[model samples]
Target: MRLSFPKLAHLDIRRGLMMVLWLQVAIAAVMIAGDWLGRNPPGAPSSVPGMSDPVAPGDQRRRFDPDRPVPRRDAPALPPGIDLPSTYPDRLTFERKTIEGFGDVLLLNGSIATGDADRLSSYLDGASTEDLPATVALSSPGGQVIEALAIGRMLREAGKNTAILPGMACMSACPYILASGEQRRVSPEGYVGMHQHYYDENLYMPAYFAVEEIQRGQGRTMEYLIDMGVDPGVMIYSLTTPPEDIYILLPEELLDSRLATEMLD
Candidate 1:
């Protein structure tokens, strides 16, 4: 039987209200999904400094065109009171020194060239037989990037502290090694300068190779910072500085980057 006009009108109103409620639910669902995606977008790096959240296994990496012009870095000022090394060191040497109050400390001076990490390892092994150093002091003009990185890993694994002691300098890859310290200290008279990674000596290296090397080193450094719980933002200064000059971090900048947990008086 056909419904009365009044009953039909009532039925229509109910159906309309139900439809509106369903539409509202659908909109809310979409919004929730959008927010989730924004936080864990495909191929996006972690926004939080010193943390790595790898992309899900199935996520595709975003690739950029190779022909794009790469950005250039400006020359940075030499660190105050530091003179660039006239030449790479003949060799890296590890010295055992005793500080007046700090007890035994290992001193790493000169260039961090190839085989330097092996030398450091041998030193540590021999020293451990007697007594390990309370801290490893760095004073170098910097050298091989990979050697410095290896040295840093060894320091971290050995659970030793690192420092730029008074009347000393630590520049270039030295800062990377310094980051491995369980505790890092910088004396007022100490220096820690930073610069972009130097992968090759050839000035006319291919752009593609240079970019590739830089990206590789950048990834390693970022990972190292995260592992050490240090803020990777410190790299901003390094990346901006050309390989020739140095970017000396002010006291506040050093503290901000967590590079110096304490500054000795």
Candidate 2:
């Protein structure tokens, strides 16, 4: 018969296992804390890990709405040859950015909110007195009625041409911007929509003044259409459509209504 060592107690074995488990849990918690601290080092400016700059409120372009603001989602898939610019300017208003490969062309993709005209003016001021962009590629869902008019007028005066490339949209007050273009073109895969301007729910203007202001804005737009060689009657589509809904004109309708000088095939 061989002598046997004393057997370990079950309670003692369980306690040892529990101690190991607790040690592992503590180690895991320390590791997690270390990773978090490394990512967000003390005294560093708060920022998204991957973003170059801090996100700004109302930074994204959106569909124009009298009652609410809806951010624009990424555009739908487009034809292979269409090139959308990737560069975004640092400003918060409607701005111009050079297309990466196309030096002469510029992208204006944003809402035409208040003070946007001033922003545009500053962009134009960067150019020589006689020289300006050859083309202004547009992708917008529109914004403040008066601001859009101001920006459009500036575009027209400068004789800048405009286009909505594939997978892009130009709607609401955007059509006014398009009209201001000396030569307006719409891609078959692009969209151009229109709707009436209603009283902005966020504003506190009197109802009578709101109505009068809208009428005045409409009249100015009609005159602008005439000046741009587009038919003033196109206002009919805008006047009848509710502000909340858009009337996307068909390719043929765009031509017939004179909203587009030509459709890119």
Candidate 3:
């Protein structure tokens, strides 16, 4: 008979499996250590250093540094007397007063100084066509021709019935304003007159500088009066006549001169 080897009884299947698992764990730990060593070698800058870095207090950018403390921003102070201008009264002024009972009767008194255009326009801001039953109580020595014309045109367009009140006088460009009214009336003492318009020739310097701006002004006045529906002869006579002769024409004289539609009783 052939010699047969007896079956080996020294192998333990469970113990062999445990030994294999231990070997795999050891290999994984070694691989992880090697990878860590490769990535961060010796002599590299430490994330957690042994010595702390100092920051200077005067440095502007120190607050922005991640490792440093942040600084607070200071706010600016406001200026003094915020409402000072409102407290002070205006040095140059124009007065536009409304008279009671006269209903829309606006009194314009003072030397029609500069900036009257804006002031007058503002005064009449709320006025409407129907409110034209209102009258303008004018007592101006005179003012800018352009501004006066603007006021006259505005009144005419509003269809305001204008009458130079009994005691008030309309002089210079003011007369043109009266002519613009649908019905022009005057008080017993209310004088309506015009003289040559004058400008400070010195203000214009070289251009339009003339001693005879009066004549030029007269021509402009005549043109404006005609456009405002005043008789051409009335305008011509008013402009050419001396200052003393510019009184209201008598009813007979007005009719004879074809200036009046009907004489005032």
Off by over 4 Å in 2: 1-103, 128-132, 199-209
Q: Rank the candidates by TM-score, best first.
A: 1, 2, 3
Q: Rate the local accuracy (lDDT) of all candidates.
A: 0.68, 0.65, 0.47
Error of 2 at 257 (Å): 1.9
- CA error at residue 72 for candidate 1, angstroms: 28
**Against the true structure, what is each candidate's TM-score?**
0.64, 0.62, 0.49
The sequence of per-residue lDDT tens digits that candidate 3 reaches over residues 103-149 is 44545554455566677667567556454345555555455666676
Residue 210 of candidate 3: its Cα lDDT?
A: 50
lDDT of 3: 0.47
lDDT of each residue in 11-75, candidate 2, tens digit only: 58778899899999988677666645643358854222211111133222223342222223343
Error of 1 at 186 (Å): 0.4
**Weakest 10 consecutive residues, lDDT, candidate 1?**
62-71
Of the candidates numbered 2 and 3, which has the greater TM-score value?
A: 2
Runs of candidate 1 with Cα error greater than 4 angstroms are: 1-88, 200-204
Clashing pairs in 3: none
